[model samples]
Target: MKTNINNLNQKSIAVDEFFNNALFDKKKGYYSTKNPFGKKGDFVTAPNISDIFSEIIGIWIISTWEKLGKPKKINLVELGPGDGSMAKILVRTFKRFPKFYSSAYFFLYEKSDLLIKIQKKKIKIESNKVFWIKDFKKIKNGPVIFFGNEFFDAIPIKQFQVQKGHYLEKFFRKSKYEIKEFYKKAKNSDEKKLRSFNSLKGLNFIEYPELGFQELDKIIKKILLLSGGILLIDYGYLQSQNLNTLQSIRKHKKNDILKNIYKADITYLVNFNLLSEFFFRNNLKVKKVVTQKFFLEKMGIVERAKILKKNMNKLQVNNLERRLHRLLDRKMMGDLFKVIFAFKSNNDDILGFD
Candidate 1:
């Protein structure tokens, strides 16, 4: 179905326009205004789902911190910390290791002003120990441990479709109020890559978040400069050649991505393979890439769940089992979501993947 643009203001915008206006316009954007989360948000994240998720990550972080020589001042950086639930759990978990907690500095790179406020309320961090910045560039150089959960997918991506051996961009014409896919001669490199993909047939569309890649490159450089490491967890394929992964969610239900504009969450699957290549080219060592099931299972998610369920009633135990299964089920988020770790130092194998 086509979008009804006639009823919108003459300057009515598309999702990309709204995002660009909000993020880059300097004058107006949702990030500059308020927090969007919980039941009122476009979608939910793993941290919002259960404390178990963060508990596992907390263990991972502490293990990694130990490997990093237990630095006196480590930068604990989280990108797009939604509502700070994970951060709150992480800090609480780290408190068990008093030395680590005392030596670490927490930093959140977030764009949503509203979410930042909510995060402040949710996480009780000392003003001198915790910081929030709108961009990663503001982060100071140090021994860094970075985390990005379902972050890259939310970044805006440019969409393209192959037509008669040519590539065309998908654009939203404000006047037309309809999504339009038009073609032009593809760039030599882009055309070469397109030709390499024999699986794309008929009216096939592909989205490449060049901006996301660029941002990743910058972050990687920063991490390398600081002699740091990063852990990225998201739902994406390892290959670059694929069809459109663009999708939307509203009230936990999938919706046409082009339907509601900014009213819903818009995202596409991440390409971890491309991301790995980007990091490898920058001389960063890829420690490992594995499915969430394998990672969490190695991290003893089952054991952890059992411990949490030991005191619960039959119904509670059943619910906990279901949630654990859902989290680790191959057909669900387990296989779809991948975990990749890249480090500057050649330490032993990571806990979850080892």
Candidate 2:
């Protein structure tokens, strides 16, 4: 996890190392080369599925700002903004609230230049309003809100297997014929980290997001310096299942994790319980984790959909309903996805969590 090395020329590389290369290698990474959103792409996200979803999130941001006493200057950083579609919709949604829109500065925190280019193309409206930052150092005056949709899941994860009271970390080694799996003794530091988390107890297989936590360390520093929060909405579990959830998506279908290289999207499910522990361990307060359905319903997505349906034709209405089902039905993304908020503020009333 310490190295950015992606090439398999080495004898072996940690799981996170290889996974990071799959999604972020400068020349051959999946995100560095393509726009993996929408029907033609591997899979679609909630924001792309419906404008109502973005609108609801926008409203939540505004409410959150209000709870922070409506700061004259505020920053909203959308972490790893995919194709900038959500931020694009957010720009339009913010405009409706002139006070928030004028004071708000949108920062799409993306590392991929190719994805940034695609985001810039989609968010051409009010070019000045949207800015891209590789990090969060320049905005010194305002409280910042760090938000990510399906963001943490994409961050590379380190896999470990328990072996007779010892830990063996998983790695990928490349041969002339193909890439293969191997294991090495776990580092002492990683073992110490695992011991600190109660959620990880009694697990034979572990998918620890060491790299993702490193990224969050940066975000956590900003939240502590400023006064706002970090809200993450992603598909994950509240409890650790003690199973390896790593998988790939290609052409809207599941693909072998080792076969596709950088041609497919690679990810592991986020563990909310572990994340909650992480925030608390960092001295930040965590709102109780809630399902995406509960959060959106509290934020009024259903009501927003009703309002939009009044103006649409039958076919359009059906499509809208289908999108809502995907987003809110318990049988679909509703129960499968979760929302978590961590902050350094006194106001405990985090919108949509109550």
Candidate 3:
């Protein structure tokens, strides 16, 4: 379903707008079309990679709930919960902490109905307690400990390139056959950051997470209202810089972004620097960004693995070991994926940050 741009009376649109359409256009969006996860799909996530990932996250959730005074009823929300593997594992693990498990309600926010069906099949343990939210309004105001793994990166990003000391916004042209760049002056409050980066020579490229920032702002408000915290894990740079991280993945292999719109998963690296600044400016408590390896290690992944290996067979142990290595390998997800935490107050020290 190719959108007719001229029919909408538009010759060109900003990069983020184009990306939003290609990924969430209802009829032709990548997520709207089919399941895009696992070995058969475009790529696999940490949760799908191994249950150990979610076990540690489950521990983090329990720790956060305890820190939040263990509210009788807490809303445990997961944004972009693909296939619900994480949620399923989390519920199973929560059974160990009966107080937290019984007090928790699962709220999932997913845009695709097809994937939602798959999530339903995978998530059967807490089916009675699970609620699918169409919008943030449906989530009741309570202690909300939210998790967003690789969620922010999927949000559309606007690309800007510096040319001869002038910033040009990248835009896709439907009138023509190629992408176009237009010289547009900065109009946002964050223009000061641009001025600071002006001294860098050569072709400087930067991505602005305007939509991601807006979504996070809304999420922060929800968490703040409930006096709760958020754990966001994704592959990105801890410090912002002039570079392009837009990438395309098809069947677990990286491909050209321009290959086919809405056919492959198109995403950009998240800017934790901007996200941390947003949280701080809003008076939310921000934790020091840590690598996934550091965060998982702090959450006791190595210890957990040791305990599980005692009961597993030889092949099971080997597979488990491989998944663990992939998760902590410095050359793989370990150094690349970063974790950041934000909360409403600084009362209790957040786990996995130290």
Candidate 4:
């Protein structure tokens, strides 16, 4: 069953169909055609916000490298490295530790050829030390240090809502305009689990268990086989609960998620509780789960801000302070974002705060 919206009056398409077409289209997916980033793009990530963000992450990665015994051949893997800003910062910082830099092999798991070009231009790691792959499975075994910032939210999610005492899966149908609703009753046990999770009266929840588990399983299996760790940073909650977090952003402003299917950035808040549970169930050693604010504060963001401010004028200092607050303030991204870590080695305590 395909819904054709080519003749529809509405400019927007259904979210699911839109993503399917935009990302998986055999001929012309958006990713196949363009680079999405910066002020003109749909949204900005932490690495784009400031070098400080990636520098801190680099520091943590270096510490983790030491904990992993500074393996001679370690894979420093990043998923969805936007514009390569984080990778650039990481490589620059890693250079300070020549031993680690010499041993590390940078592996980027990215899909967009356009963005990969941008990343190549932005990051200047040794050509021999860096490589790119579309899938994680292709990478051979090694001590791995994985980083995924705001990557999970972008993976397509199955939105659902409980109604009339039954769990209904949402689908989009194209007509005059793209229409969306609980299109059908879920039949599979997985769907049943989602329905049960959403059954609480007056509660609405969205689940991405399939995407979440698949990624987790892939990384966990690799980490289990080879000693390594994963650091995940994203906006989310510590516990799974009923709430609507699907949102769209364009030109740094919030926009209706359902209004422009392929033209804007689409994301949903991650359920860290489920992620934590996943690692635990997989028998991987859980390192830490904490808010980004707390993690940054623990990593000395305040002191770093002070040092940066010392070199700037009053106006520059004020701007730096605001940016710091925006990233760490509870009223802003502070409470909205979270950090989680899972490690194969059980001895070392993670450097980031919990």
Clash counts per candidate, in order, are 4, 0, 0, 0
lDDT of 3 by residue, 103-155 (tens): 98888988788778889898886467888886778666678887889888998
Local distance difference test, candidate 4 = 0.74
Q: Write the per-residue lDDT of candidate 4 for residues 46-129, one digit (tens) a residue.
A: 887778888888888888887777778789899888689899988898889999888888898886787788889987766888
Task: TM-score winner between 1 and 3, please give it.
Answer: 3
Global lDDT of model 3:
0.82
**Superposition TM-score, candidate 3 onto the true structure:** 0.91
Cα lDDT for residue 157, model 4? 67
Rank the candidate models, highest lDDT first: 2, 3, 4, 1
Give the TM-score of each candidate: 0.85, 0.96, 0.91, 0.88
Residue-level lDDT of model 2, residues 1-354, one tens digit each, is 444434566658888988888899888889999999999999999988988888898999999999998999999999989987788889888999999998998889998999988988888877677788997886676898999999999999999998777888998887876888888999999988887789999888999999899999999988899879999999999988788899899999999999878899998899999999999999899999999999999999988888988999999999999999999999999998999999988888878998
Q: How many backbone clashes does candidate 4 have?
A: 0
In candidate 2, stretches whose alpha carbon ends up further than 4 angstroms from where it belongs are 1-10
Indicate the residue-level lDDT of 152 in model 1.
Answer: 82
The weakest ten consecutive residues by lDDT in model 4 span 1-10
lDDT of 1 by residue, 1-354 (tens): 123333333434343444444343333433444344555665667787678888899888888888877778788888889789899998888889899888888888876766788889988867887889766665675588888888887777766777655676554544354644334454677656545433333435676666677677777877888877888899988766646787777666897765654455667787777667667767888866789888888888888988988889999988877777777899988999999888798675567775
Positional deviation of residue 94's Cα in model 2 after best superposition, in angstroms? 0.5
lDDT of candidates 1 onward, in order: 0.72, 0.89, 0.82, 0.74
Model 3, C-alpha of 144: deviation from truth (Å)? 0.9
Best by lDDT: 2
